[model samples]
Target: MDEFAEARAALVTLEKRKQGLIAELNDVHAAIRSQRNKLEELIRRLPVSPINRLPDEILLRIFELILIFGTPRTEDKNCCVRWKGQLAEVSRQWRNVILHSPCLWTTIRVSPSWNTARIEAHIMRSSKSPLDIEISPWRNSYALKDRPLLRRLELVVPCAERWRSLTISSVVSSSTFRVLQRLDHLSLPSLTSVWIERFPCCEPGKFDLPFLQPQRAPLIEKIFISGDIGMLKGREIPSSVKTLAVESTSLRWKITSALLLEFVPCQRLTSLCLGNFTNSEELPPNSIQLPLLEKFVSRGGVSAALICAIVAPRLKHFECHELSAYPSLHDRFVAVGGKFSNVDHLELHAGPQRSQRYKPPSQSLRLAFPGRTQARFSTGNTLKA
Candidate 1:
């Protein structure tokens, strides 16, 4: 019995000693881990490249140029992600510079492929800089429900006060239009430029925005609308608008002189471009005079009466498409020949030749300018200006 008791006591002491050694081993491992962490922190603090020697301002300028030229084109989500990754992976210093530079994040392009986390990261990094927002989808890709894009729009809509320009090139779904309608209630005081293209077919008032009201977007000075001319049919354009562009693949309805006048405020315009306007009727007796207009461009079947109605006294440059196809309009063209008397530069595009009967007589469409005007003429295969 005594020997058995003694053996049991020895076993207890051995077990205790084993536990003590295990505790000591654990302490040693913890100390090694702490030392490794310290070494890593020290290494990070050391400068390893000569590029780090550049001043912050110089680095900022370089970053600005990179962003300016490296910005992804419309619907190019992959390029945008690659650019963000490349800039962040260079080094800790570069990453820090990119994160701290608000201008680098100010231009936000959102597509359906972008994840929520990535979009939020961009918004956070952009800070308080004025934002140039572009929302579109990849070309030739299936149009799926873009939840990420919708979420991004919801996130950025609250920041509309800081928006400098907003461009929507996507096929706006019903949900998208609903969200846009909310903008009418919000104040976009800083929004100066807006461009909307390729809007999906919707009801007459579906795409209307209150921000378009001259009272709402008082600072808006430029507007560009493409795809549908119906989008501008009944809207009252602000007098503050100086530059305007309207383009369509084909007109859904005839653009009358009154409709054209409705799109432009009574004030002088700086630059005006009208493209693919197949059917334009004559203006009313009161002409639409753009006294301060410097540049004017027209394409497709624009009416001669509409051209005659525009009295741009200071017009410097004029461009138009071939007018020979409209036989009945030949006399109208001659009547308006003297309207370009002050135009110094002209470009007439003689479009694809049809039957010889449709060919315009050389002298039938002459410009009787008081001063010499440098003119360029372009046919389908040749160019003579």
Candidate 2:
């Protein structure tokens, strides 16, 4: 009996020791966890990264790359509205980066595809950045009144400081000029291309917006007109004017021809493009002796007399795209012999061998080409073909 009691006491003692060891282990684990949390808290309280100490300008530049030039999706390709809006939603510094980037903000395209309010906001947000605005309004919607759009455009583009290319279009109207006729003063110093078309200025009194002397927009490189080029005749274009493109809705030759002559005064002219001016009266005002006038294009028929004048000059190109036979037109060019002295780049826009029948413009044009040989013509379709 004594031995069994002793054995039971020994077993109880061993179990008590095991239980005490487990309790100690639990206390040790709790202490370790408490120490780990305290260490983590201390680490978090320490001073932040050395990278955060960058200067504001350097940080701003980093934001600019991420917000402006980050990805193809971020770039202002065709003025994507979603990308623009997304940029605004980024961090405040990033927003500033995008707003300051002139290239990202310069172009604002107002179209049926985008929210008009959004477009307006973009324009407003651009502040002093010179705008490259392109708006093609919906067909059915009433043409935007001059007051709503032009007024806003005027606010942004005051006197054309940095505007490079401007294209203004008006929808159909019952009035003389398809829209407002008071375009006397929008001289842009940086303007390179001006294309105004489909201007329904056919009415007699409508197109005669009394001649205002050429307000100078000196850097112009290319000019295209399809609506009434009524007021520009007789006025000397700024000498910087280069390529001239004309497409008229009028079929009358007198009107189209006269306007062509007016452009001859542009002494630096290098190219002339004519579209859909058909019929007989007087040919395109005497081909301005553009010594530099290398390329000539006519989508409609070109009279033999007109071709004769072209051959007479230092033409690098004589491109006639369409031909209609007018009897006895070739007599004068052949009679004078092919004395077209300077023509080298001859492009026939029509089917084979059309130039065989027609004669180039007169040799007399060579002498008169450099001077103010204005087109004694008139028409409204100076832009629309």
Candidate 3:
């Protein structure tokens, strides 16, 4: 009887083990069914485009990058490329699309003074045909020396008349310059960008800046002037201009009440960058306001008091760089940096100063903090970086 009872107990243990294994198998099967059902629902909801089709807009936007990054220059005989690479790692499909699309390889950019014949060769070598060209004239070029490049550019670009977003800088004889007074003399309709850099910096009193009459391109919105700008009174800036960068090294600056009044026409302008404002004086008593001005950046001696005086109510951003007279102002006990009641952001460098070369220009010194004084800087965000 005892032997029969032990064998029966062993049989009961085997039955329990079989039941536990079956339960675990049932739980795994249910989990698999739940995952499969979720996957099927997701597959049904997903659109085919994300996996397969690319629209024309996306293709064009991808292709426009060639225009933006431009072509790369290389001396190796084995590597003739317009631009270096960037889009390759985006995806296999994009890499294939960019590689196959010639437009994505063609828009070539060369700095000024490049030999025109070589650029012509590069353009020819490109398997993908390009219609637009951007060239920076750092200096004149021999290859493009005689070509009707200005005219040819108009012909080659589809947006000619309205497509001229380029700058030309050359110090020509006073006689040749007379012919260029009307920027229309260039007569390329596609023009959009204008940069005029002149050497032997001229002042507004000596050289007349390039002028744009009332009916000039409706598209041109940015104008930058460097070198000597002749009396600006004769030239009427395009009324549509939204940005103006004007620089002059000459001390012939006249920041009188009348000059501030001249800023009225530029009310359409929102950004103004001025450099070399030489004098350490403020605006003449009551100057006209810069009604629409939002940002003002200057590079040289614009007085701390004068900036506060002239900057209108609408101004939002102000940056002053490389102040002219830290050495001259070091004799005073005043600080070297501070913010105006109006300005929210201010930057000042007590300019690595050593000693006073002359008397301080301002009655009070704001940016004059020295390391030994435990001085407090006025800029809320001031620290030596």
Candidate 4:
């Protein structure tokens, strides 16, 4: 029993020593960390090197270039929200520079899922700089009562005058239209471009916002609308718009050749793209002459008769996709010869010969102009000119 008691006492002494050693080791680690941090601070306070002595203006320009070139591709796996934070983390001076530079924060991309406070900070940092705005749904679905999205829109509504470009994609909620209606009361003189792509789930003719009126966005020169062009009918699109693109899945119900004739100003259009129109029989009695049109792109069930009807004297490039099986339309286009006489490039995609589906079987694109024109063919089912 005495021997066992002695062993127990010895064991207790060793455990006490072990605890003391552990405490000493922790103290040593803390001291090392403190010393390391002090050394880092001293290093940071050292004089700037010659390479780091660039002018503030030059540094600001470099930072702007970094933001532009460092834009993450949509397919990139990394989180896009980290890009600005990563730039600021490079150094204390960089963080200060980024914070003060309003131009760096001018372009804001907001998703419904983003934190509201972060988005508010972005807007505040942008100051009075012209904003290029892009709003897309958080996931594939933007519910009608999404509070985050509504709050974000409320924050943006006050800055409508500073908006240079506005792009909204896959927004199906009725609340989106309600938010856009606020624009009707505000003048967007600086707004130059507007692009809206509605979600496929949204019913046709659901996007008839009064803000689409030409007077609200007087300076808008480029307009692209996808899904249901019906709202555009009888609505006076600005004659100053130079580029117009209309794409729809249900073209027959939404867009017609007559509607195009009534809405689009032939004299002002420089680029026109019409997608997914299945109308084969409706051709205007008189051929609409587009005097300034340089590029024309048509896709998906756009009848060859409709192609032959439009006259563009200065047309340099003509691209047609999923043309009907009517070979006579091609003959008529070649027969007229003068309709697109100035066309330097021509792209022809033949529709499926067996089935009446919209898919094309073969694509033949040619650059007929005599000069050294470079033709690049992208390897895909769709053809481009």
Candidate 5:
């Protein structure tokens, strides 16, 4: 019984000793945590690198410059966002700065390869800032399937009201492009610039952009239409458009005169650029008035029909590219007694023609632009002013 009593007393003593050791362990853990925090504080207080020491405003500006200058190509839709992601991963402070800056996320690119979640994330991050959206789908074999692309596009269509600039390039058939028909009746109040390129149309017919009506897009000022010009054949350019460019990049199909004339009704245009015409068609015998046109640029084979048809009293700048086509047009202009009497500057650029030799029409420059104060003429190899 005495031995049992001794064992009980020893057990109580060991329990008390174990409690004391646990208290010491707890104190050591607290000290280690405190030291770790102190070390971090010391490191932060030390002199930072030049970039890190910069004020947040300067850093933000630098980030903006990176986005502007680092873009290697226009088609690299996700390049800027990728760079932003890398920049945010550098530190917690950077992530916070980028996350809070809504302007940094305003330029949204909706490529067919991207998922719907990323698209929604961009819209959320942009907050209420005006958006510059580029919806460019992949071409040919690399293209994503239609079902996934349609799902992604569904998220972007509702955000048209926030669009400041919209570029939609579709290389697919007309049926695939019908996905955008949902945007037809939506109001685009903040939109000022639009660029549409539709390259392939297996089911070819006129594709009207009823969304571009002046009532829907009152603030639109610039319209650049390229690729298959026939797609937008019957669509009317907004009268509020200050600049209009009708160009075709396809070497396969030349822009038709009927398609070209469709934009002639933009009477309020200040700048008109027409290009990619290989065929000269007989335009309707009607003189169109461009009362406010100040700058006129003609690229590729601009038909004499268009040259003679326009009546621009305010024209000051006249530039013609692919001057190989000019000699014939110039002769036609002379034959038709065509002249821009108010043109103050004239430019002619020469291009290669396999069948014809180019001769500088110096006399035509004087006769065609009687009021020109400056003139520049280029041969295939030389520039003369």
Candidate 6:
């Protein structure tokens, strides 16, 4: 019994010693943390290094440039959001610059797959700065369920008045774009540009997009649409728009002169691009007059009908691509060659072709332009003027 009692007392002593050692260890850790903090404070108080001596204005401008142009493709979409946080951690000076510049936080990219709280943080940090908002459809259409898509927009709709630009990309169906119908009532007073693109095969529903409506976004100046002509059906594009690019990249539809006249306020357009789809053969008896049109770009194929239809007296730059297959249009363009007499520069590019048969059309374009036009011809092989 005495021996057992001795063993228990020894165990108690060991336990007490362990507790004491643990308390001592904690004290040592606290002391180390205190010293580390003091070292950090001392380092901060030291004379700034030449590299860190850049003026705050210059540093802020550098940060803005980095935010605007530094997104690399390999990085995730949220890298910009991360950059603001990571840059702030570099030094107290950087943190102060980033926290004070609300414009740095105004480029918000919203996707159904991204976290809502992170988006909320960006909006909060932007304060009242005008926002460049992008509703990204990077995920497959199947992944963007109706509920989640609407939820994503719900966070942004309240900020509509501050929107400077809005890009809605890769929508694949009416159902996918239908969520935008929720925005029909919002007033986007500061919005100046809107770009919308749909997947190639989706139905081109007559979407009543709010930002392009005459009254909804009074200051809007540019509209770029990639997939559908019917996207302009319900809304009248405001006459304030100076640049209009309607590229029907899909084979399902062709942009017609009637359609262009119906939706686009042609007299106000200074730059027009008809892109990547087959040109319509049907034409009205009178050519469409674009009095102020200065730059015209037609891609994939430029048809004889279009060459005959558009009369741009102020045309300065004419850029046409994939002309190798359109030899017949070359002769037709020769018929209306006088229309572009004011054109200052003409660019003709023939995409990769099976044979050098592209050279004939390339030469024809050079000859087709009026004597005053400075022509550049490329057959995807050689560049000659």
Q: What is the TM-score of each predicted model, taking all chains together? A: 0.72, 0.56, 0.53, 0.72, 0.74, 0.75
* lDDT string, candidate 5, 1-385, tens digits: 9999999999999999999999999999999999999999999999888977787888888888887666777556577878889999998878888888888888776665567777888899999999988776656413444555556667877888999998877776452365455455678988999877764442234334543577888899998877665555445677788888877766544556445656556577899887776645466433667788899888875556767766788989989888555346456455334358889998877776522355555576567688888988776766778
lDDT at residue 185 of model 1 (Cα atoms): 76
RMSD of 2: 12.9
- Would you list the C-alpha lDDT of every candidate in the order shown? 0.69, 0.54, 0.49, 0.66, 0.72, 0.75
Question: By how many angstroms RMSD does model 1 differ from the true structure?
Answer: 6.7
lDDT of 2 at 262: 54
TM-score of 5: 0.74
- Report lDDT (Cα) of residue 15, candidate 3: 93
Kindly list the per-residue Cα lDDT of model 3 for residues 148-233, writing each as its tens digit.
Answer: 43433333333334334555445442311321332334444444456655523334434333235445455567777665554453
lDDT of 5 at 367: 74
Error of 6 at 319 (Å): 1.7
| Per-residue lDDT of model 4, residues 1-385, tens digit only | 9999999999999999999999999999999999999999999999978636876678889877767666557744224446668878877777788889888777776565556686777789989999988776554334445555656777777888899998877546344454455444677868888887862334444545433556667777888877655566566668878888787755345566546656777788899988775554556523677889998888764554566567777788877666556653334354343455577766656565523333322221222233214333222354433
User: In candidate 6, what residue range of length 10 has the lowest lDDT sum?
Assistant: 199-208
Query: lDDT tens digits, residues 129-244, model 1?
Result: 88887776544323545444556668778787888888877654343454455454777778888887764444456654755776668888888876655656667778888888
Residue-level lDDT for 60 in candidate 4: 81
Q: Name the candidate, 1 or 3, with the larger TM-score value.
A: 1
Q: Which is the better candidate, 3 or 4, if ranked by lDDT?
A: 4
Q: Write the per-residue lDDT of candidate 6 for residues 208-324, one digit (tens) a residue.
A: 467767677899989887765545444466889989887765444555644666677777889988776566668652367889999989786677777778888888898988874
> How many collisions per candidate?
2, 34, 32, 0, 0, 0
64 Cα displacement, candidate 6 (Å): 0.7
Tell me which of candidates 4 and 6 scores higher on TM-score.
6
Ranking by lDDT: 6, 5, 1, 4, 2, 3
Off by over 4 Å in 1: 1-53, 70-81, 91-93, 137-146, 171-184, 248-253, 278-281, 284-286, 322-324, 327-333, 336-344, 353-374
lDDT for model 1, on a 0 to 1 scale?
0.69
